[model samples]
Target: MAPANSSAAAQRVIGFIRRTQAPRQSPPPACPPVKKYKSLTEIMAKARYAVVERDDYSDVLCDQCGSGERPDELLLCDKCDKGFHMKCVRPIVVRVPIGSWLCPKCSGEKRVRSFSQKKIIDFFQIQKCADLKNKCSSTQDAKKRKRRTSLILHKKRRRLLPFIPADNPSRRLKQMGSLASALTALHMEFSDDLTYSPEMAPRSANHADFENGGMQVLSREDIETLEHCRAMGRRGECSPLMVVYDSCEGYTVEADGPIKDMTFIAEYTGDVDYIKNRENDDCDSLMTLLLATDPAKSLVICPDKRGNIARFINGINNHTQEGRKKQNCKCVRYNVNGECRVFLVATRDISKGERLYYDYNGYEHEYPTHHFV
Candidate 1:
């Protein structure tokens, strides 16, 4: 009876499980909708650490003008990719550049050109004051102006002192004053004094007749070139080169003794007389300076009729051929843009108020010893 009862209970439990178990239904459609959890990549992308780039680009700010670029228009440098205001460009870029655009800093070339332009303007302005000071010397008002101008000049001079050669910096002013005194004491004849004479002719040293010869007129280009020389001297910017009358040296050029090499003393650009078969004896004219010469290359430059202050440059007679007493400046020829340009270059360190002289002839021969001193 116990075994039958246990079997009945097991059947009942099995029947109950079978009744509770539901029949299996058909599989759901392949495209059935379901709630989906985000993938690892998608979740990380949504996280704050993920870098997501937007479609819209922010406007760039100009480095020079310090202005942000407009959404519609902006100039970008092809090299540095720095944006710049179109109007802020030097020379003011009006139209969009056809090709690659470069900012002032990115271009690198404009800075130098800009600096040179600025320096030239400053030089001319400085010269205008200097000229006024010299002209207004007769009046009391002029005296006051001179004093003010001197103060301005003194500051510039102090700055330029380092470049100038002076044993005693304090005594440089005194020495310059003495040099001026010495030069003033010497009343040398100036080329400007020469007057036109219809029947003038070149004569010997004893009876030189500069008046008889017709004045050599310079071309428009030559006049413009000389203007540059005038600015250099009057501006007192680079070399303290000045034309002064020296009793012993005659009319000569002098530097404020600046420790400068290859300093442009003066630009000798005028009617360059190119002589192919020219001899040294051919240089009979008093003002003809030998510009450059090789075995076959003989180029002479005569600045008598059309020259800058270079025409007034006197020669230092190095009679002894001693290196110590040689001239301070040299005549150099440069090939510029396929054109030969002549310039007076400082050869060595020059002292303040020192007379600048160059050898007329390359060799140290005393051919014109009588004319020198």
Candidate 2:
């Protein structure tokens, strides 16, 4: 009876131990099934817990001079709340203007119209429309259907194409600054569009100045839009961009607002000279306008003395991932009006305050960008 009691007690104790350990030995409740994320943005959205709002202004300083002196004289940007001294800003605001004023950065953003609202057309289309209008008469009933079909086709092709400059004269002057004066002193004229000199023109009647096989011809609608842009450009209006002086990168162009992919930013404007003449040139912003089959006929654009916002744009270091990530714009050589033209175009959607960077060497990878940031 004593042995039986002892065996039963031992069995009871073992059973109790097994019951307590059963929960721990199980498979961790199957781990609640891991979530699969489709994109980095989704993961970021999930990881974010809360947002902290900033209400402090004790550390405000002038964005231009980096000084907080004469706080009353500092003009706070209505959009960004960044402070800037009246004298430090371009054009030197003598007194506050009548209405709401935006800083250079904010003003740039406001100047750019949304891509959805803007029209992009081809140069050839304008010529076709003008030719048709000159040839067609109001009595030609048969041509009406053809014209209607053409108009419909053009309407279908309408899309957000490129940037339009601001119409405000004061703002335009401020953006151009002393660039014209500097160019004039160097015997160069500031041009916002490509110019063809006698040397840069096609040498022979059969010699083609540009390769247009891959490009699309512009429609009449596109021509009207281009004309409007040209008129604005002639008035010293520029793309919705701001040139900010960086201590490290010198001067860099920044997008004032969101920009869509393939949006035409600016034409690389300068004196078109033979490549042979500029082979030993020290100009860092030289752009290849044409690479003719004949080496002697090749032309390059020298933007050292006269250029628009494109000259200030920095190149990206394609070797590093960080450097490549910084690139938002691309340099594309387009054939416009039987002439080779270089244009800076947006490669991806660019956000406000982001600096523009493009591959300087393009596919050839000739230019060294090791020190590019």
Off by over 4 Å in 1: 1-238, 257-259, 274-298, 322-324, 363-373
Mind giving the per-residue lDDT tens digits that candidate 1 earns over 217-293? Answer: 33343333334334434433334555555433444666655646544566653344433433443332233323332
Number of the top candidate by TM-score? Answer: 2
Clashing pairs in 1: 164-258, 165-257, 200-212, 256-352, 257-350, 257-351, 257-352
Candidate 1 local lDDT, residue 342:
50
Q: Give me the candidate number with maximum lDDT.
A: 2
CA lDDT, every model vs. true structure: 0.45, 0.61
**Taking the tens digit of each residue's C-alpha lDDT, what string does model 2 give over 194-242?**
5556755433321234332343344554444445445445434456676
lDDT of 1 at 180: 35
